[model samples]
Target: MEFVRLLLLFLHLLGMGMLVAMFFVQRRAGADAPLNKGWLHAAALQLLTGVALVGLAPLTDQEYDHAKIGVKLLVLVVIAGLVAMNVSKPKPATWLTPTLAALVVVNTGIAVFWT
Candidate 1:
């Protein structure tokens, strides 16, 4: 189970990196591509794996668990909203990519250090 959890964590981070890279590439190119499809897919995969990790991990009475879960969910929702906004506007916002990437990093930190 620990090995599986570690693997899932690795996959989750890889997916997040892909998504962040896609956003940066889009920013540089000034145009979107079918690659955005891959970004969305990766983001979804990360979210799934992250949730699975939380579910499979042993229970703890620490308040940090609930806080971490809440923050992760909030960040996920923000990222999804950013994606939706970009889709609707036909262009990614100036701050969207950086903001989402920062959120991901912060969430990762919380998972690694707060727990």
Candidate 2:
């Protein structure tokens, strides 16, 4: 189980990297550029890994602060929403990439500093 958790964590980090890279790539390429599939895949990966990680750890109100989980989950949902809204576009809105990157950073901050 720990091994699986670690693997998921690894993939989660990769997904984050992909998302951030997508933003940089988008910045370099123009709003009219076709969407990159990698960004959407990363969003999905983060969602899946994050849920699995919670299940693996099983945070309880009595033990760990579940509020942090809730907050993170909400942020993840927002990120997922962003991905869903932009995934199929031939050319995504100019705001999507930077917004996605900012949201991901916020999520990361929540994960690290929530305790």
Candidate 3:
């Protein structure tokens, strides 16, 4: 169970990294790059792994803090929603990646710095 938790954590971070990477790629492409499948996949993985991590925390003998988890979950939902909304667009809104990236960073900060 501990190993499973670790794996989920890894996947969660992988998804976060993927989001940041896509943000950079989109910025570099300068509106030429549409939201790719990678974005959706990453968002899904991030969401799934995050929930699973919370569910599995008890198995690892960790206490679940509902407040922190709830905040992070809310941010992730926004990130996922943004990705889903833009995935099918021929040209996503100019603020999409910037907003998503900022939210991602905010979530990460919450995860790392929240008590």
Candidate 4:
């Protein structure tokens, strides 16, 4: 179980890194399609793996009470909402990607330090 947890964590981080890199690359290239697909896939995978880990972990109520976890979840929700909103419209890759990347980093930080 510990090994599984670690593996999930590793994959989650990898997905996040991919997302951030895709965002930056897209921003530089002035292209959105490739980055959008990559970001969507990475974000979906991260969310799935993250939820799996949380379900598998032996967490107490006190652990759930931490502000960091709440903040991270809120960020995740915002990211999801943004993704949904932008899925149909065409716009410059400015705010959403960076914000999502920042949230991913913050989520990882909270997972590492708060737990």
The candidate maximizing lDDT is: 3
- Give per-candidate clash totals: 0, 0, 0, 0
Model 4 Cα RMSD, 1 decimal: 3.3
Cα lDDT for residue 21, model 4? 85
- What is the C-alpha lDDT profile of model 2 across 1-115, one tens digit per residue? 6577678889989888887888888788877887777777788888898777777775321234589888878887897787777778788887778878899899889878887
* Model 3 residue pairs with clashes: none
RMSD of each: 3.5, 2.8, 1.2, 3.3
**What are the TM-scores, per candidate, against the unseen true structure?**
0.73, 0.83, 0.92, 0.74
Off by over 4 Å in 2: 58-64
Taking the tens digit of each residue's C-alpha lDDT, what string does model 3 give over 1-115?
A: 8889889989999999998898888888788678776777888888899899888777877787899999988988888888888888888888888898899899999999998
Considering every candidate listed, which one attains the maximal TM-score?
Answer: 3
Output the TM-score of candidate 1: 0.73
lDDT for each residue of candidate 4 in 1-115, tens digit (9 for 90 to 100): 6778888878988988887787677677664543366666777887888777777767412224447656766877777777777766666456766777777777777777875
Answer with 3 or 4, whichever has the higher lDDT. 3
So what's the TM-score on candidate 2? 0.83
From the highest lDDT down, the ranking of the candidates is: 3, 2, 4, 1
Candidate 2 C-alpha error for residue 9, in Å: 1.6
